[model samples]
Target: MMWPSQNARRMWATVATFAAFLGGFLAYLNVEPVAVLFQGQHLQNLFRDVFPPRLAVLWERSGLWWSVVETLAMAFAGTTLGLAFALPAGLAGAANTTPHGGLRAAVRFQLSLERALSSFFILMVLLIAFGLGPFAATVTLALGTLGGFGKLFAESLERVEAAPAEALAALGASRSQQICFAVLPQAAPALITGSLYAFDINLRAAIALGIFGAGGLGAELLLAYNTLRYHDVLALALVSLVLVTAVERVSDFLRQRI
Candidate 1:
């Protein structure tokens, strides 16, 4: 019988090491997946209570539709605000478009720090200052959008064809003129696509923020959950799912056209 080759031996050893570590973690955590799923009445009760969702709540609850509108408004306003700031930040952050190396580094670092902080955490802090509702949530979403889109916009700008900018530079065009004509034109499509994607993400974030008293469908869901109105909670969940799916579909269509 042929012995295993060196590469094959190493591959097997790697797999064995991963398996051992996984097993160790499972044991240490005292996890019993099989028992948890099959032995618990909790799952059965949840299914029983949440099934046959109360879709009628859509009409019965007068403010439900308005809350949905509020969520959409928050996302739109936040994305617009973020995009306004992010465009300048992105220009400064990009290697080719930046005025100076130090500025680029500083902008990149600030964007990274903003991205590292959770949007929900930011919302909580803002709630203390702004005192609840959509204003705080809007600002939180705007900051998140700023951090994410700033980096995306910078990368997009950097990826633009260098030839156009080089040609402009050879023609004795100023730095700002070269960027405005050569760089931005090429990056426009990407920027538009990224903005749409950012709005999609912000919409979901707005809904989640509402659960913490930001005021939207999530708030209604939380209220229902608190009162043990599982049926209404299920109904609200379906509404949220539909809203997200619809926005995603619209975003996809727009991206395809772009």
Candidate 2:
């Protein structure tokens, strides 16, 4: 292969130097300091910790199964609600579909306000409003969707087939009619895909929140961890891995189909 020119070599040199500096800084901070095999005492524990795995924990309470089901339900409900609110809000915010620039600005402002709210804070507020229950966790998931998906939905509406909208306007269609007949058709695939992606992510988030007293398998896992019930912890870990894999498979299938 031909050697790179001096400019290319300089660029590569800069990249290598930056990489080495970042690695050094990370090492200084001990981010995963024990990542090194055994790193000392961990190696000793490794020998002692290894034992027969318990697969029975999967059916121990039976609710592990139910919790998984409930978790999925929570994910669906929160996503649907978020999308429900996002649809009209997105249209109102869209520059073309909005009735006026001022109303559009207000929609944009509310969308911005939603984005500014933190997921963790929303979770806390839900906990206060509804108590430490799945309802609170579901609200947090919806808030997350509102921030991320709402913006994308608005942008999609703004960029959809303007020609069709103009044609509809020429036919003396109202703004709502233009949106229903012209805008939504062009934007459906992208908008639905975004919602699906957000739903999958919120599935994982719901699980974590559930673990943190949001009421689900997560709560059980947290309990197992706190009690030093390593077997239960391992079981829950495997269950979560399966759930995450299933979500990924479903997401990939939708992506291909959509």
Candidate 3:
């Protein structure tokens, strides 16, 4: 239909432009010959593949149970190691908690230095020193957590209510004593929750790093995919989704309770 009115002509032009843009997208820009992507086949097996999915094949090759355990173990262990360093580092890096400004600055600087270094590079160096396995993954998780969690801890320290801490210090309480009573007690809930979140992140990174023989479900998953075992891929996918969801829910529940 021809639109004689000026407004109608403009509307039709807009529609044309939008249609052209959409069509361009559907007709993808092929950088290579068409045959290269699809192995020069027209893919006529569609109807057969469209039939009911085969769960038996998925079960036979997926290795669902073992991979889930391995992935959870990687996440749990990495997070625990990271939190172990974060607690002490956070305590040491706080200005109010340290007796001397110099000590606080020194520790804070170290935390920054750790954050600046790349975890992948650390894994590489450690792999040479310790060889590939959870040991390398653990070191990477620890150093990475030290920087990230230390910063969070230090910030939390700064944000804690100061009046009680001030009173304790005025009462001739030592720096550590004031921190234990006034600072840590007030901030413990937040600190604990933050560490859990950090652990979750470290767990994901540990899985990814495990690809280079660091030993975890991710390492196994990669092997499955490289071998073209789609069943195992499906299995890894399902298990990973479940574990990640469980961790996230638990972490969220704890954080909300805090």
lDDT of 2: 0.81
C-alpha lDDT of residue 202 in model 2: 81
lDDT of 1 by residue, 1-258 (tens): 545797789899999999899888988999876788899987989899999899999999899999999999999999999999999999999999999999999999999989999777898899999986789988988999899999999999999999999999999999999999999999999999999999999999888988877888788889999999899999999999999999999999989988
Predicted model with the maximum TM-score:
1
Q: Which residue pairs of candidate 1 clash?
A: none
Q: What is the lDDT of candidate 3?
A: 0.74
Which parts of model 3 are misplaced by more than 4 Å? 1-64
For model 3, the run of ten residues with the poorest summed lDDT: 46-55
Residues 1-258 of candidate 2 have per-residue lDDT tens digits of 645797799899999999899889988988765466646677666435533345687877767788888888888888888888888888888887778899989878888887898677778778998976678887777777776787888899888868998998999999889889999999999997898788788888877887667777777788878887766777787888888888989898988898
Ordered by lDDT, highest first, the candidates read 1, 2, 3
Q: How well is each residue in 148-200 modelled by candidate 3, as lDDT tens digits?
A: 88889888988899999889989999878888899999888878888779867
Which stretches in model 1 have alpha-carbon errors above 4 Å?
1-16, 27-30
C-alpha RMSD (angstroms) for model 2: 3.1
- Clash statistics: count for each candidate: 0, 1, 0
Looking at model 1, report the run of 10 residues with the lowest lDDT sum.
1-10
